[model samples]
Structures are given as structure tokens and as C-alpha cells.
Target: MPLSQSEVLAGLAEIVNDETGISADAVALEKSFVDDLDIDSISMMTIVVNAEDKFGVKIPDEEVKNLITVGDAVNFIVGAQG
Candidate 1:
């Protein structure tokens, strides 16, 4: 079975937390990494790597800039996993 939206979001939270040293509780479904989490470019790349490894999906470099929120990351994972 494919992962659900919540599952994807949870996975993303785990990735972001592990990379940025931020607690998962600090992030929300609607949170923006830059505006809310204060994530820098390097941390964002860390998130990308973590997501890729966790989901077993390769996100193209060009699409990296497009992932701005938790929902965006979830959508990307769902699309790629399909």
C-alpha cells in the first residue's frame, strides 16, 4: 500500500527534526521551514537527503526549491512513490 498523507508528513517531520535539531512538535502541517522553522539552505538540503533516503525516492535538484512547506514535501513524496 502507498503511504498516506499523514504518514508522509510524519516522515517529513522526522527528517526535518533529525537534520535541524528541531523537535517534531515544533513543526506543523502548515508550517514553512524558512518563515516558521528558520531553516537555512543547508538544512533544507539535509531534509531533501533525509526524505530521499527515507522514502526511497530521488528528488531532482531542480525541484528542490519547490518544496517550501510540509504539504509540499508530502505531495512530492506521494507523487514520486506512485
Candidate 2:
């Protein structure tokens, strides 16, 4: 079954937290992975890979650039699931 936005966000938050030690609660939809979360490219890549595994979605390297915010990633995963 496909996951909800909130569900995806929550899971992503956990992945971010695990990778970067950032709090899950602080990972809101509007927050940018770079500017807001202070995440570097390497960390972002790790997060993306972990998210792909956790969500069972394949996020291509070309498309990773477009996922700027937490919401963007969540939306992509949701859409990919469908």
C-alpha cells in the first residue's frame, strides 16, 4: 500500500535524524534539506538512499537535485508509490 504524506514525512524525519542527528520533530515539510537543516551533499545523498530503501522507491541521481525540501521528497515518494 502507498504511504500518506505524514507517514512519509515521519519516516524521512527518522532517517534524517539517524543520519545527521537532527531531531525528527524539526524536519517539517517547508524546511530545506540544505539551507534549513544544514545538510551537506553527502548527508543528503545518504538520506536519499536510506529513504529509497525505507520507502521502497527508486530516486534517480538526476532527480535528486529536484528534491530540495522535505515536502518535495515526500511528494516524490508518494507519487512514485502510486
What's the TM-score of every candidate structure?
0.90, 0.97
Which has the greatest TM-score? 2
lDDT of 1 by residue, 6-76 (tens): 88888888888888888988767788879889999998988898888889899998998888887787888
Model 1: worst 10 consecutive residues (lDDT sum): 24-33
Instruction: Give candidate 1's TM-score.
Output: 0.90
Model 2, backbone clash pairs (residues 3+ apart or across chains), number: 0
- 1-82, model 2: which lDDT tens digit per residue? 8999999999999999999999999999999999999999999999999998999999999999999999999999999984
Candidate topping lDDT: 2
